[model samples]
Target chain A: MDKSTQGRLEAAVEALIFASDVPVAASRIVAVIGEVMAEPAPDADAITQAVESLNARYDAQGHVLRIRHWAGGYRMTTTAEMAPLLEVFLRRERRRKLTLPLMETLAILCYRQPASRPDVSHVRGVDADYALRKLLDIGLVDVVGRSEAVGRPLLYGTTQRFLEEFGLPDLDALPNLRGIEELLSDPSFSQEKARLFMLQGLSGATEAEQP
Target chain B: MYRVKLRDFDGPLDLLLFLIQREELDIFDIPIARITDEYLTHVRRMEAVDLDGVADFLLLAAYLISIKVRMLLPKPAPEASDQETEDPRLALVERLLEYRRYKEAAERLATIQELRAALYTRGSASAPARAEPQEVLINASVYHLIRALRRVLTEAPEAPALVIRARDCTVEQQQQFVIKALTVGRDLEFSRLIRGRNRIFVITTFLAILELIQRGLVVLVSTAFDDDFVLALGASGG
Candidate 1:
């Protein structure tokens, strides 16, 4: 393609991603650009190349925004460096750290998609009803379908919102499940445990005064 | 009285994992006797605070003690061809290992979430329109409020008997009571609202709060304590 044609395609891709509130799929972008240009639709590869070129230009020029491929689509998001100022402007609350229960319940559903309440509960050794409901409220997990077990319980799975929120292109992008030995050896593990113990100590001191 | 905070530990397995990690014990060869003793201490602490899910911890405590007993019991004589005896701790160890894998996965997810929080998308330039005006309470579901109510109910003193009283405490009256109380102070701790009240009064007030929340007259905000929540004036409230 000529330089002007490539520039037009890049500009079109940039416009679509910038205007879209949700991520714009490559096919939708191709169709839109193809109809506007009155030519054969550009393939996914062309769109990908356009995105790469646009991102490259943005990076070379030190632009704050970048096109990110998330949840099977392209989205224009501000670079991480601008987050602090953006957060202040947005008045965003400190992101609600997922409580331990919700995190555990989410991890279980993430790995074992379409799992029932009983399945999660069996693994965690506690009723997962509360955590599951909280996750649903957070838009991370959703009822995908029903199980084929005795009572046919509702099966839950991670939602598209989950993928987007985690910045994962797909479930395949999930970090590898580290083995127990590796997790044990991780220095962060001990640090987290120590922090939890300190929290426990503070709370335990308060509890001693009660009754 | 080391009250086991439900938020800190997800469940019984989580508590067990904590004990093991604290001691740096080998997961494969957990010393059941020592771990069981430490586990019971934490369980007792949970009971002392009347935590929401102490029963789950207690159940695991029972299993741990049983394992300790089995370890103490004598083994059968070795056959001509020695058979490998199954360790009583084997099942528990496997369960712990499984739980650990997911726990680690959860941490990784948390990290991913943190990184994702930094990137601002189109609609995320401003705070997303929320159902509740309070951002903290956006994640606090009705179930969480109900759990807090459960704690209050358990702690409430029983009603006095032998008094044939009229059914004067209706939902509307309690609703007015809540609204009026909040009008005095913009925020009210739920437990404080029902403190020194009878069972009927407490139950009626709880129902009133639920109704107010449904109508967007009040919002339930989570406090530092899991068993307690704060009620604030909603967007439409007086």
Candidate 2:
């Protein structure tokens, strides 16, 4: 495309992202830009290129704002460097942090989504009712469906709000869940277990007596 | 007394992990006797404090003691290879390992949440509005009220010599009592509502309060201090 056309496309994408309260999907941007420009719809690649050029310009000019791909869409967000000032302005310091139980419950649902209350309780060895309720209140979790197991308990899953809050572009963006074999293979794990075994053999009774 | 609060640990597994980590004991070869004794000590202290969810801890303690007993029993002659006789600790070990994996995942998520908190989005500046600054009353959940009830029960003086009386009290009666009490006073502390009442009365009143909350006849609110909750009239109640 000509320089003028490329410039207009970039401007349109930037405007859509900036004007949107929530993240704007690439397809949505392409359709709007195509309809407004009265031409064939631009492909996803062109939208991506426009976003890249916009980011490049922002970086070259040291702009505080940049477009971020989040929750499967593009959103305009201030750079991380501005967090402190933004925190003060937003009073985000007062924001409640998820408690340990809540975090654990959320992690379980995130990895083993559509899980029942009993399933989560079995893993944590504690009733998850409170944590699950709190998560539902926070809009991070929701009842996705009922399980097929006996009694057909309600199954919980993470919500789009969860993805946006965690800054995940999609569930696929989640960090790879470490497997049991991987965890067991760590040298430190084996070494620690061995050392403890030896210690137990040496002074089992005395160690048990210690406060 | 250094009371062990429920909030100090996430759950029974967390307490077990703490015990294992603190003693540097091998998760694979857990010193069952030692861990069981130590776990019982923690659970006793937790019970003494009357913390909510101590039942879960006690359940783990029982499991540990059972494992310790199995370890002490003489093993029957192996019909085949040594692997035929399964270790009593195997199930527990697998459980601990699985819980540990989730705990690690939780930590990783915390890191991600922290990093995500640092990045500001377009609407980040306009956070949800806070409650009126003059009085900060938090909306209390059933969990919070349960904790408060535990505290009240702990502080309650023991009942005098038991008298055989007719058990006429019902949840409906307690509900009426709560409604009447609320009518007399604009707001009522849960502890005060059940104060000096018999155990049966306290329990029935609690159930009644829960029912009231469910039916939109009552609401539980608390200040920054969470030791207790206040019951106020709900929209329907008003």
Candidate 3:
């Protein structure tokens, strides 16, 4: 490809990541690029160079988002400089923060876990698929395995981050439900979940937590 | 007891909404029995598989059974002064509905992040770029698509009923597999290579991936859904 085409390709890749609300892997980017481009784009190296160049361009100077490699994908996110405006996107007023639902569902899972989605719905009296997805995206809950019963069900459990966020020493340290009242009062429970999760990450929890 | 991961979450309301929506029932009027069945189906599916994605969904199951029982059983009539008997789900459901609205707003705001990235070229244009979301609207509407996926999953081939036994898949094997495919075919879709393979092989596949990542021979990525990681042959080793 000519230099201009290559540059356009790079710009397109940057634009896609910028537009993505969440992180996506480079393979997804390559697939989208190939679909749009008439000729096969120059290899992934060129794409990587293009992304790196764009990242450097945004980082060296001031830019809205710097390309971040996250969750095994490339995504565009706001910089700390622009966090206030993004907070506006968060919209605290008149909004039932995610804390309530997330906490409610999380409480159900942590306590009555190895249960089913229906079991959770029965207890919480609402569908939890969305929360489940959000939880998955955040790296909080995970599938433990199938039930041994005639009708097996997926079991849910808390990660080390769950302990870290709650300021618990470990899963064993998870306090009993007696603190529900206190937990219900703290609206930041979900936000805290997100905060500690982002800080610690899904995989490197303890090492990152220790810091 | 492996830890649960929650990265795919939209919000808490999304979870409640999913429950309400699962039975293809109204959010206001819940068909407890059917809802329970569908809910359990999701749970059972999780129990059947060992993927991390199903963990939280399972824990919520028991709580669901409890609410169903409470709603089903006739309670002693509260005295005139007694607080009105609540629909056990009332508090939690309301919270879900409310959170759902904010979550939508968050999604909108999140999309703006995407537009800002795509439309603007920092320093090049004094003014910000306009957003482009024409085809973007064509996303799997989280609500409808999930139910549809659940329905389709019923028919998806039973991967295997026989061997739940864990295997010791070595990374060396996956590296060889990636190399094997690349050597055989010039190019391959990532999904095609990963599917129909043994579980033990996945570890090896991942090992091969990391090895290639280090050697600069192969690249792994997902095309659309984060469901599968696609591998593309890079030029370094080739």
- Residue by residue across A175-203, what tens digits does model 2's lDDT show? 86676555665674776664453353323
Per-residue alpha-carbon lDDT of candidate 3 for residues B22-100, written as tens digits (9 for 90 to 100) = 4455444466567767767655654454345555565556666787888888865887434446556654444444344
Please tell me which predicted candidate would have the highest DockQ against the true structure: 2
DockQ of 3: 0.02
- DockQ each candidate and list the results: 0.31, 0.32, 0.02
**Residue range with the least summed lDDT across 10 consecutive positions in model 3 chain B:** B128-137
Candidate 2 segments whose C-alpha is farther than 4 A from its true place? A192-211, B1-7, B80-84, B127-238
Error of 3 at A115 (Å): 28
Which residue pairs of candidate 2 clash? Answer: none
Error of 3 at A98 (Å): 18
Give per-residue CA lDDT, model 2, range B117-204, as digits (tens): 7777776656463331222234543357568878988897878798787676899999999988988897889989988878899899
RMSD of each: 18.5, 16.3, 25.8
Residue ranges of candidate 1 with Cα displaced over 4 Å: A181-211, B1-8, B78-84, B126-238
The 0-to-1 C-alpha lDDT of every candidate, in the order given, reads: 0.80, 0.81, 0.56
**lDDT (Cα) of model 1:** 0.80
DockQ of 2: 0.32
Q: Considering summed lDDT, which 10 consecutive residues are worst modelled in model 1 chain B?
A: B132-141
Better of 1 and 3 by lDDT: 1
Error of 2 at A172 (Å): 1.4
lDDT of 1 by residue, B1-238 (tens): 2322334466889888888888987665688989998888777765755566687787788889998988898875667334435567766865776787888889999999999888889987544745422223235433465578799888978778878767669999999999999989878899999999889999999999999999999988667778788999888985
iRMS per model, in Å, is: 7.1, 4.4, 14.4
